[model samples]
Target chain A: MTVKELIDSGKFEVVNVGAATDTKITDVFCCDLLSIAMSRGIEGAAWVTVMGNINTLAVLSLTDMSCIVLAEGTNLDQAAKAKAIEQKITVLRTDEPEFKAGLYIHGKLG
Target chain B: MSDTITLKYDVSTDDFTRAGEASSDVKRKLKNMNVNPEAVRKVAIAMYEGEINMVIHANGGVITVTIDPDCITMILADKGPGIPDIAKAMQAGYSTAPDNVRDLGFGAGMGLPNMKKYSDDMKIETELGVGTTVTMKVFLAA
Candidate 1:
């Protein structure tokens, strides 16, 4: 599904400015453990995480994640968002918990 | 073909924020060197796990990465209290990291296992009163 469709789904909150309207998400990986995510997450998968640290963006870059959706009302720190923007990575925020966000994204992208 | 490249990094103890910098830099360098994506990913994950382990368990350590045409080798050596039991340390959920480290999203006890899972070969050398050195290799993909 396209990032625009995800935004319009009304299931997420856009708390950052890095969302790209035309970006596509092929799969979803929901995890807070950075190592597990790096090992198990497919390249280009949408990352659903509750972490808000700057290192999270660094991990995303290594994994080559397509987009990131922060769950449980967690928002990206300003510096992190800026670095992500510099890297052209899309960032999304949502009030849904990590599991629910994973389910919702799976349902849409499946 | 004498095209081996070596990179070294100093991992600081108890520094959660800078844990993965070395691994990330290596990943970028490998990508630029036209290494296979799968091999790059494996090396990145394995080395990153080791780096985190160094910070969490040992105070800090030295990571030396050697890249050649046939394989990539990572040597992580730390001066922290050595592992009492290599078998138990390799378990997926047996961690010696304190609760505070777990709060940072690590201490999951998957570090050593993940390193072994991703690398083609792994060796552990430790002394109870001294330190530990973990050597992992990922063969270049054919």
Candidate 2:
């Protein structure tokens, strides 16, 4: 689904829509470990994690992920939020648990 | 892109907020150079891991990236307490980073391994109490 659709679904609140609203998300990857996520992350996927930090945004940018889904109600700190904006990273927020958020995106992808 | 491009960055130990700036800049420059995406990813991940290690363990370091048509070489040199056991440190899930770094979601003992996994070639030269230097290269032809 496109980023706009995910935003419209109300499953996640929009934190930053850096990637165009029409950007397509091909899959979902759930991981909290930054290195593991960087090594294993797939391009065009929506990364689901509770790591709301500047490093997480850096990882997403390096991996070319479509967007970052901050699960479990996690929010980016001030520095991370500023970096996200400056870097133009697409960030989404959800109150659901990490796995649950991944499942939701997975269901939609299928 | 026929001429070699060299970039240098000084990683600061004082802030975790800016840890990945050097790697991020490298990634952007590589992409702009129209380097292979796979190669770019490898260089980015490998260099980023090295950058984080400098911030977490060393008192920061100097990263020099030399990019040519055939390969990208990154040299990360830091003056900090060196790794005592290279063998054990190479193993996955081994980390000496303090608890605070762990809370930052790093220090998982995956840094060196990930750097090795991504780069085409890797080497480490270190001395206890002196420092450590990690050299990694990612070939662009792939």
Candidate 3:
């Protein structure tokens, strides 16, 4: 699904629409550890994690992930939110646990 | 773009939130220079891990990136307590970062391992209570 479709699905709350609103999301991967996420993250996947810090955005930008889904009710701090907007990273939020978020996206991708 | 490009950054511990700025800047520069996407990713990840290490473990440090036609060399030097065991430090899942750092989504013990994994060549020099310097290279060759 494209990012616009995902946003329109209403499954997640929008934090930022990101630079590429129509980029096709290839897959969904869940990991809280930034390093592991960086190494294993798929280029166009949506990352589900509880890491809501500036470094998290940095990892997203570096890894070229299409978007970040803040699961388990996590929210990026002020600095990270600003960074996300500045870097044009799509940021979404879901109150569900990370596993649930990942599964939802997985099912959608299928 | 033929001339070798060298970039230096001073990592500071005064603000933990800005840890990856250096890496992000380098990534942008490499992308502008039209470095291979794979090579740019490698350099970004490896250097980012090193930069975070400097912030969390080493108080702060200096990172010098030299981009030649064939390779991108990153030298991370810090004046902090040195690694006591290189072997253990290199092992995955062994970390010395405190709980506070872990809460920030770091300290998984993957920093050094990730750096080594991404870079084409890696080297480390450390002295107990003195400092540590890690040099990593990512080749731009296809």
lDDT of 1 by residue, A1-110 (tens): 87677877877776554645576877889999866776787777788998877667777777877778999888877777776777666678888888888988999886
Candidate 1 C-alpha lDDT tens digits along B17-122: 6778899999999999999998999999999899988988899999999998999999999998999999998998888878877766677788899999999999
Scored against the true structure, residue B123 in model 1 reaches a CA lDDT of 98
lDDT of 2 by residue, A19-88 (tens): 5668888999999989898898998899999989888988888888889999989989889999888877
True contacts kept of 2: 0.71
Q: What is the lDDT of residue B122 in candidate 1?
A: 98
How many steric overlaps are in each model, in order?
A: 1, 0, 0
Instruction: TM-score each candidate.
Output: 0.89, 0.96, 0.96
Count of backbone collisions in candidate 2: 0
RMSD of each: 2.4, 1.2, 1.3
Model 2 has a DockQ score of 0.81
Q: What is the TM-score of chain A alone in each candidate?
A: 0.84, 0.94, 0.96
TM-score of candidate 1 to 2 decimals: 0.89
Runs of candidate 3 with Cα error greater than 4 angstroms are none
- Model 2 stretches astray by more than 4 angstroms: none
